[model samples]
Target: MPPVPAAVDPDTLTSLLDGRWAGLRADIRAEMAAAPYRDPIDLSVEEHRSRVFDQLTALAANDRAGLGFDKAYGGGSDIGGSVVSFEMLGFGDLSLMVKAGVQWGLFGGAVQLLGTAPHHERYLRRIRDLDLLGCFAMTEHGHGSDVQHLRTTATYDPDSGEFVVHTPDRGATKEYIGNAARDGRVAVVFAQLTTQGETRGVHAFVVPIRDDAGAPAPGVTIEDCGPKAGLNGVDNGRLSFDQVRIPREALLNRFGDVAPDGTYSSPIEGDARRFFTMLGTLIRGRVSVGGSAGSATKRALALAVRYAELRRQFATPDGEEVVILDYLGHQRKLLPALATSYALHFAQEELVAALHDITDDAPEQEQRELESRAAGLKVANTWHATAAIQAAREACGGAGYLAENLLPGLKADTDVFTTFEGDNTVLLQLVAKGLLTEYKDAFQNLSPLATVRFAAERVLGAVAERTSARKVVDRLTDGDDREALFDRDWQLKLFEDREQHVLGGVADRLRKAAQDPFGVFNAAQDHVLRAGRVHVDRLVLEAFVRAIARCTDPDAKALLERVCDLYALANIEADRAWFLEHGRLSTGRSKAVIAAVNTLCGELRPHARTLVDAFAIPEQYLAAPMLS
Candidate 1:
């Protein structure tokens, strides 16, 4: 069970996982140390990637590459182990982390999830060994978020028993693809499958990009996307296929199959269902991205907090270079973000575990539920990561801008996160669509009397939305006295209120638009998307609360609880107008939200380093001194 109301601790939380995993984490750090280039901004794109591939080769050689995979794939670790190790890579550099992610999480995972037994036997080891690097060619220039609209097509030829893959025009070319510029021998290209005039939705094809001689394959056009704002170490590029023919077996037939006679069959019947199932496989990538983003944010905060302690500015009357952390403004800027970093870290762990559970044993619907959760978590965490890193950089002043300090590179590298895997806005819209479906399902289950109950419940749900911080404050200060209402539950509920209010806002808007559905949907896409984002935000907050409750270490638990409070408080204050407009909180309570957040920021200021330290990043991966 999770720790009780008042005794939550951080050390207990970290202790839930085996500390021996830190050894593999250390190996990754050593691999990073041995890399040719430590700072990517200082190296040309080719040089950066060349060095990254070299480092990846070293890590793969040492058997550190398979930690989170199955033993059959030469991995000795599980999902938690993989996450712990991958998060540590952020301490070295974000670009290296992305490149490593592509190699293991994408290429290897694609084979594991989408390929059959023979496919794995033929390509898994090579992918793991880096003997045959590959890129996931799913996104297209004309249809990034809309995977169903891709123009690339694969037509089957029964006479030759081959699939002719072609990107008919420039708009259909795969772009922003990692590992496409150099070293990839094959790609898991997604294209429309057609046979006998019946076109199936997107399917993954193992298309060879380079011949055995390491030269470009015929009919394949690969071009570099050039130097990007971040992840320079990744060979992000564009690929266009022109009637490229591959054997019938090239199709990843795990869920669907293509026969020698040009017949295509899938257990999933609908074109849309098959497409969604394929997209669901990418949720693991989203989870990994969330964890990676959290790790990077933690590293940035650690650097900024440590520097603030030693590097001082104007002092008090006693005459001393006061530590920047001594200023409330500095704490305000960095501490809450630090708190959010902690929440995201714990939340990501839970998401990974939840995904592992469903993928391993749950039914199809359960797996889809987990998939939605992963998508939601990805949107919430990554968006927060960009904001958190920027805050950490600004808190460090000019030192942060210096490439040597790692902040500028960290910022540049992480900038793409909000877009990669899925754009933040697009993903949130997906989450919104999911929420709408869920609501409709729940509403449909109601009978005549239950319909009245549902109506009443909806009114109550709208009326009782509570901000997380206020919940905590009420518990902490409930004696009919202002301070007596400062209960932990009150603080937690106050935090929950923010989420409920936002969701209610969307519900209210949609309810009003029930009269003109198209106008509401067409004109209010942004609002609908925002509502979906709010629902996702609520889900993440709940997960974070649950994870902290599960931590065993008392002090760590207590600290995490405080961090959770800060995270919720900051968000509530940031969106106070929602609470006010919804009649959930008064203007006075709204102001109280800001004051409480500020106060909590001050309380967390002292333990900021301790919170990030609990992450246990290896020394070499630590990047710099976190404290004087």
Candidate 2:
């Protein structure tokens, strides 16, 4: 059915992971090597930050910054290409990637996305050239996720015709701002804008935070956050502004604006609409994070799987030692993760395509849909990186624990990804809301007869799926129908049906929830998250299937199909409890799934090196001596 799964052929491996941009990645890698970015793992926070600053300066001098901006401001205007390169940068040093992202993706991006042409014309070229280093000042001590409640205020002064920005209390201090401690000269700060005695919600302003010689400006207080668990190379710090004044022109007034005379105006009418629209422009950050996380997952899986190939454990009766990977337990931990790493890789590529579509002038609704998808995938991929990296560490045993192995660093650095960009939980809640919103919209315009039919179909579909699941589980012929059991169509169908069942149940529950609103929604958080996971899982699998379908070579496609099958079965095995509870999997069928997964792992073990080799990490950056 899957054209007889074949062994991986090294000749076609790169095409599998590169998606549609192997050349672009190669070009980026070459440019990165020419720049000769260094990791400098042993430097202290201060020393490391200084070293990174110097590296960034070198990059800026090389005209390597602002890769995503339009050519008018000295950038290449290739958003997809830029993100591809940024994702590859993660394979080297995460701190460097993050610091660069801080400068280019967050700080510079705020101006590029949220600001009008004036902000770009006056500052972007200098920002790209490193003449004006800026920090994205958004997250505050008291308000990380709940930014709507931020206490920082930028009140307009009619007489002075300026915006006076102030942190009302210590809690309003900007925390964990990259480049703020030492190098950044300016900040794109977000604060509640007040004019004519009315708050106009959160807005961005370009304000100088540091003056000549890197000193805090007149009313700005700066403090180094000191050593962190990882990414010590970044100069993350806290800042508080006490009545800092900036010209009215400093406002990045694309979405909303304050007139020179202190009057407020915006094309968007509602406060909520304006807020979301402004943040939507910054969705590239989430997209970039997902891409980077996918790359990081590949690197870790490659490093660990390669080590497992060479590292020997207990000897067989013939006095020949077993390659640790020969053990079932070892393969269980690493191989499925290997498959998942592949899944994330494909999902990230799909995200990039969706982003390109939006950038190419897709409708506003399409852009919002992609934004929600990006948020979900960002959460999924980052969580995958965290899990995959940890599994890689454990798979390698003691050596993996050593810093030189790279697992230690990968784990610590990626752990924060689950929190940043948006907490995974919060982001999932967003996904759930989107799904629920769509569900409501679907039913909104239905005629009375059509509404009844729709409701009847949903209810009957659940009943049919439940019945079909029981039959599927009972008919599963253990390993005899192994080929049928692993059918891509069947596997995908089961996953989708399960998702449909869950969504239908949740929709009914949420309908009842409309009364209490707050209490019901809060109580349904776990269900909401389940819906998000199932949705993401479906997206990942769909992407994997489509990628497999596009493979030009036979051997590569067959082997990748196996990996895809592994990803499918591994997830099925992990969620077997849910399947069983829902009558989608019988005990025998579930056990068969486990056996099939183990078999797939053993089959893939021979190709482990080839799999990781496709990651194509520069040996210098990978620099894990054990890997060599």
Candidate 3:
């Protein structure tokens, strides 16, 4: 927006992170080598899921496995390092990545984050060792994203110091739970907590599903979900508890606790806050998934780039079928996504770091902030991964569609990303709500109009800054001055303001919907979905802008400029309506934006390989050669 920073180089960001993935490369490669190969899409619903469980077991068996879990409990080391290893799994296979995620990220992380020290010591090591495979049983058949109203319950009893778990109906049973059938010996089940006739909201519990010999535990009935559109290597299932009873200690007593005397107390006040805090622990796992999605995008883009470099098409009179990478259209389709891979990688590093700091005994407020960051990054990265992988697949023409080529398979696995770990659309709505809440609290008003008004004032300030500033960055750099270009604070302001604007727009839309319940629900769907996407896009752009600012190399800076240019233009063009509606850009400026995108595509053509090369995904990891 502010004369796309001239000096910021693309390679600068790559070097800034200093190859954090280097140390994990050997383990990543070895895991890829040792990992079993399974065609999830080719199996029967039952066999497919069975294979998924087996794969999970196989991954857990590795000594270097569970790197992301608690080191004291049979894990490798740091959660950050584990994430690095998980991401690289995409290079070998997507199903393995996904099945492993359900196992460790969801199932194991639930125990790690939601469970207390006692629960962790008692069951976590077994989970890590695969002696007790488990499922994260939260989503019910009827309620997927709406977890608050789940129909299952855990009622405390002083008679035997036990609580009864029951799923009153079909919808109440947990559904679409990974690793639930055939393999799981335990489950981290979430059910309403009721003590002394007072019903608290959703709480997590550790429930044993099988005996030592792997037989179904008493009163728990598990049914395999059979099959679905994607993620076949996951043994998804539904479970119903018929008056199932377990010790009162089964509840994960980290955030809240229940004594043997049936007294319940939580460090957090209010039913709503307690529920949210428990759910807030999920942010780390979501952030971890975002990192994995980033890897998926890289793998897919690498495949496309390699194929494009070698696959020739119609050429000029000079007589050569032009390499697809030579085509401006292909560059337009692929290079920005390649740049996004960079953005996602750096942002993920930041998110992981933020998570580490907040989780390391920081105050509650800091933890909440980390959760928000995790939410924003998770929403942005997953949506980008799904879209990028699909685009990369199509960019390869036919080969991408073949299973052998991997893109098609990768796409299938990533497709579920939009739905699981909180639906992309739903997640953005939550982010919008979070932003609106902050706006109201910061400004001392909850009204949507008040929030919008405050945001409008902020925008005015930004516009004034744009008008009166000394243009500190403009004087700093001219043509391809990547460093000074990235140094401009205006770009960061643009991102901040853009997010606020979109969030305000969503609030306004929600308010309008309140006027008529039915009409608003129907109309708000598309409007809210759009706002959510815009917010995520702004995040991606902000990350790209920040990374570009950190670059020092001249050539990488130039290439990064091309990348940033394409990313900015492409995003703005997609949201032409917002620009026009808000008077941010005239029709002529919008046309120029489109033209700028085209120019960027041409400028970045030769460097497409160079840009992706910076992702540093080895050829062996890709299982294919560049320009082959």
Candidate 4:
């Protein structure tokens, strides 16, 4: 690794970090600066919701909110730019960020992706212009993670050529639905469709929840969720349908449709396959959530890093106070997390680009792979935000706890991210399921011992095939323990090997599921999660490596190389016990990994400000009285 320069140009780092969406980011930053955006510090829940709604309308009026929609609907048709715009909004009020996501990304996105041509023609422009605010009513009170078996029913009433949308019981009521409490006039509701006496699985329908006067429509019960821990600006509400009837044409029938005669037809055969396919089309929402979480983490780190550089503590023998960041403990708290934020940023950029470029006709395996990647990155980014933001709060001491300091809002608003888009634990298990089955029948066969055995048999061979060019086996045999700790290839090999080994171990344990499936799966759950986490860690490291290769400036490139090293080594150090037990790293090498992390933290400490500044968050958002 090259020695750190006296200083690296932050503009260069910013340019490299911006990647393909530099213009959109700059435009959004300028617009946010111009808007009356502020954290809802002391505002009432109603007041906060009003303010966030106004902000959402402002975003819609500028067309910034519709970048992901089709151009025919007065949109920019820039999917990646749309996601980047949402991420940039994370630097400001999180409530507004989420409001925009619900309006444009979720509500509008469902109408665009799941609905057919006539549905789009009628609703797309209105949705884009905020003439029609809507909710994504998918999560029922009974089923948050398991959407496949929702109790809500939309039975076809062929006599009147209408479908009766009904919540069978309290469990079927949609809970925590954004836009349902106050602003939403309509909702894209998910319910099991039944026609001709046969249930055709879950499908989305366009259900109007409110009348033109903004009152709840007949048979639609809307209940405000009330205030709680955070995000008071969002008007989350519960929705229940008491035999609400809508025209047959209200169904978003691109994947599955029913005729006036009550006959159901779909291009896809099985209900499970068709349902998964529909959900797959909405991957942009998951990607946006992860990217927004990254931006929030960056903001927290920036605030904490700047505070560390300014706040002076105990004096030395020379009677001069030292900056908190000058201490190794402070660096340990912030620097490695800072490095991880950078890595996740690059991985997120790659994901947004993939979402932008993927075609509707892309192969099923390719689509599934993209979904798995989105799920994994979401897990990584959100969990990192939760931990790193808490760390930032602690690093700022009592000041961070105050709502005035901004860290409190950041911490509270982002706390639900880990569970909302998808629960982090459940999502990790999904990733492991995908890997074990190679995306084959992943949703259908959740307990496939055959697939687990197949994956275990070929997992090591696949790892070797990927790292063969780096000659990881030969280098690990010949390289010195101290020197090889800094080798990027060695680090990559370690991550890959760990994932392969953990996955194999999980398979071995699950093989006994032939007798007691529940007991075996319960016992091996930890190994399953580790397999998912290590796989994502390896991908994030690779993304950082690829991003470093794209830097044109020598100093910035060198600086990024060291940042990448810190990220990789810090991960290895965190999981050193696994490596030590598996005989992948010697006792001396494990200790060397820790030493390398300490050394890297010291070396990178000088550039911490530069690292956080590259995120280029607006000054207005980072304005805390403590910093002054």
Candidate 5:
């Protein structure tokens, strides 16, 4: 958006892109450089499982698996760095990312965060070193997004000092659990806690799924989930515990505990709140999935951009064929996506940093904010990854259809990212709920007169700042000067106004419909989701802007501003109807937004390869033929 006083610097940008990442990336890159990690073939599910498992084993043997755990448990205690390195696996294979996510991020994380000292002392180091393999069994056959409704039960026996874990019915079976099918011998299973003939609530317990020799433990029935649409290398399985008993101490009691006398106690008194808080402690999986999906999108763009440069198509009048990339249509298809990838990279990095800080020592309120932010970004980034990867697949033409190209694999694998890391729809609702809760709280602590005044002020502010305000921005800038329209303040105002309008409007309608909370909320789900999307869109642009401001390299700074502007305008263009109907943009300005996007695409086209090269995916890991 700002004036560029210097040329683009790809080297500086790439180096800066890799800055601050811990050495785990170097180790991952080195491992990927090896033949086993670089295979591009389409192996069968069985073969694929073995490959991913062995890869996890190798990462563990080299002391690379526990970078995020507490230092007391042999981890580096670098939560953000661990996630940063984990996402790099996207450069290699989706299966590896999912497998490692299951092994470390989910299963081990449950023990480390939910379980108290004894559980950590006994299991953390072993999990870190791959001395033990475990599954995170939370989702059930009947309830995927609603974990509180999961039917698995852990009934306490005071006399015996043991808990009998059971799947009361087929619906209680844990579904799509990574590591359960073939590799896992232990599981951190989420089940309703029952004592003194009364159900307490859903709690996590360390239960043995299989014996040392890999056979199902007594009363534990495990079934393979079978081949999937993609990422078949992950041996997802279903588990049902038929009255399997374990020591009472097997309960992960960091958040809740039961006494030998059959009394239930928890740090959090409320059942529903306690369930969510316990689960929130294990939210790292969502963060890592989002980052990993972002990496996949970057790799896809790199592969496609490189291919477009090399694979020439229709010839000119002079009989020499032109590179497909030179065509406006092709650039339109890929360049906007490249811009989005850059925006997400910055947003995800910011999220990692924030998560690291908040998870380390922040208070409960900040942790709640972290949960909403993580949920929103994870949904937004994964959705972007799916769209970007699909566009990339089409951009590569028939070559993308080949499994070895990895775009298809990336699509299939990352598609589930939208659903698995808390289904995107549910996650957005969580974000919306957080926003609404905050709005409610703001008005709660004031006097009636103050509340009414606050309410009226907010109302008047929204009305003034709504779509009508776009005309003000337009009048301030020279409509013909694309640079003027792309101003950072202009972009921020536009995005922020859009979010405010959507959120404020939704808040009003929901307040009016508050009589039936669940029904009314369900009726307004679409608007609530829109509110969530706009908020995340605004955050992404803000991060991109902030990152550019921090850049010392002038050329890189200027070039990155264009990337940021492209991201902003492209989003505005995507939802132009809303902006136009709401009066946020005049017809001419809306078209200008599209025009600006094309202009940035053409300007950035020359640096496409270098931009993707900045992602620094090793050639071995990105084994697509086009890259070669």
Candidate 6:
């Protein structure tokens, strides 16, 4: 284990974790501390919704809502700052965090990014100011993950110069639309557009769902989805249209448009390509979801760690009670997860900066890479939150299960994250598809057979070539397995080698699908998913490595190095069976990895409070009564 200072300053660590948006993070933290906010544990569903809506309105009043919008529309025009602000909200009520994301990051973002100049001029300011609370109505009963084939239609009637949006069947109804049950006055509805009798795939349109009197528009039907497992404060509902008439200008025509004469035109040649390009421009929502999930995980750990420190159990021979955190079992549960949280925090910071810096005119490959990273990280962060928060709750035992302690709410609220923005399973496949195709027409085809065939034809050679290169590099290792376990270069190579081998193996299995693509791909589905998981694992480790290099303070740097080691070694230990199976590690070396993880846990147990305190969560969010 590397030497860490006896006591490192948490504030110094905070500065490094804050990254490019430190000022904004500090301001938001201060604002949250001063705000009149309370956890909604005891509030009724309607009452909680009311409280969250008020908070959203107050955020808009302070101009915080305009941070990501264009300055031309009275916004601050700071993209990354806006995301950081949303992440900070996760320390408090998650319902508010989700509500704010729907308002600014999704609904407003669609208007700004997918809509044309006229749409922006008409809606962006209103959306920013909360004068027009809206729903992002994309998900439907039949098409959640497979959005390219949505059944809802927006048919152009040139005779009336209007588009009639309709739900042809029950499957076309928009399900779980945020704000639709009560608050939303309009919706950015996604539906298949038809012009001159030619149906042209999925496109977004600005459609009014409610009138000034708070009644449904003439042809719009809205039904509350009722209380959910969590996030009751969000008024999710089902929306269906019965020949709702919207003007020709309602189309958000950034990539595709229809003329008054019923002529359809698009800069992109194919429907799939254009729809995906539109989706790529709106990746901020996914990025924000992942960041918010990380924040929630940090809050859970802080609560659990604080309780562990104060709650004493069992007596030692010296006649003093041992702090629960001293137990190897408790440390094993929380410290590795804490270290992983640190790693994810750095990776998220990198992803946000990339999203903020990429130009609109950048190559398609860059955009695809950015989208892939966003998808990959969202899968990582949300799944981590689900697992880590549950562990935190269990770590605190009975006290953690109480609603007032906040872990219960955090667990329930974040549960939907794995499926809402994109199903984690589907998103992982998307990541794998991008890898298999090298970003060439990857997003254009998501069907199983197409992806399998594509990988067989295009990716097999690349995988083989990378495998050969890895072999040459492997022969150069120093052969001292025990000492090399802590070497950063060795860890990097092991992760890289594992990814190449898994990916190549998948390609080989897929190459035999010449007879029955779907059946072959289905049998090898687990392998396909593994390729995606390992690829993301490598990216996250690299991001953590890069972040450590950027640290300037010696004490903080030294502490972070130890934390990163725990992260790397713990992950390897968890997947040791794979290494053993592949002959990458001997039984003795594999046992050593476990011993190293245990040693790191004991070494880090004393500094648990300092490590979590570096997150600098608002004291209000961590105020569980048991901790007192």
Clashing residue pairs in candidate 3 (N, C-alpha, C atoms within 3 angstroms): 6-481, 7-481, 7-482, 7-483, 8-482, 8-483, 9-557, 10-556, 10-557, 12-551
Candidate order (lDDT): 6, 4, 5, 2, 1, 3
Q: Candidate 1 on 286-334: residue-level lDDT in tens?
A: 7878878877887777788778887889978988679898899999988
True-structure lDDT of candidate 3? 0.71
Candidate closer to the true structure by TM-score (higher is better), 3 or 6:
6
Determine which window of 10 residues in candidate 1 has minimal summed lDDT. 1-10
Higher-lDDT candidate of 3 and 6 = 6
Residue-level lDDT tens digits of model 4 in 236-319: 999999999999999999999999999999999999999999988987888989999999999999999999999999999999
Write the residue-wise lDDT of candidate 2 on 1-628 in tens digits: 4554446666477866776778888776777666665555567777888777777776676544777887999997877777786798788778778888888889888999988898889988888888888899999999998877788999999899999999999999999998887788999999999999999999999989887877789999999988899888888889899999999999999999998788899988998889988888898778888888888888788888878888998899999999998898998988899888888788889888777656535677777788789989999999999998999999888989988778888888888888888889988888877777757843454566756766787779777877877666655654465876778878888878777777777776665454586787788778888988898998899999999888888888888888899999999988999988887777777888888998888888787777777777766666678867
* Cα shift from native, residue 187, model 5 (Å): 0.6
**lDDT by candidate, in order shown:** 0.73, 0.83, 0.71, 0.89, 0.84, 0.89
Give per-residue CA lDDT, model 6, range 132-172, as digits (tens).
99999999999999999999999999999999999999999
> How many residue pairs clash in each candidate at the backbone level?
42, 0, 10, 0, 0, 0
Against the true structure, candidate 4 has what lDDT? 0.89
Q: Estimate each model's TM-score.
A: 0.89, 0.95, 0.86, 0.95, 0.95, 0.95
Residue pairs with clashing backbones, model 5: none
Stretches of candidate 4 above 4 Å error? 438-481
Better of 1 and 3 by TM-score: 1
Pull out the clashing pairs in model 2: none
lDDT of 3 by residue, 390-476 (tens): 899889877777776777777877787777778766786676555556545534554778667766766785675545333432333
List model 5 lDDT by residue over 358-389, tens digit each: 74457878888889989999998899998889
The pairs that clash in candidate 6 are: none
Better of 4 and 5 by lDDT: 4
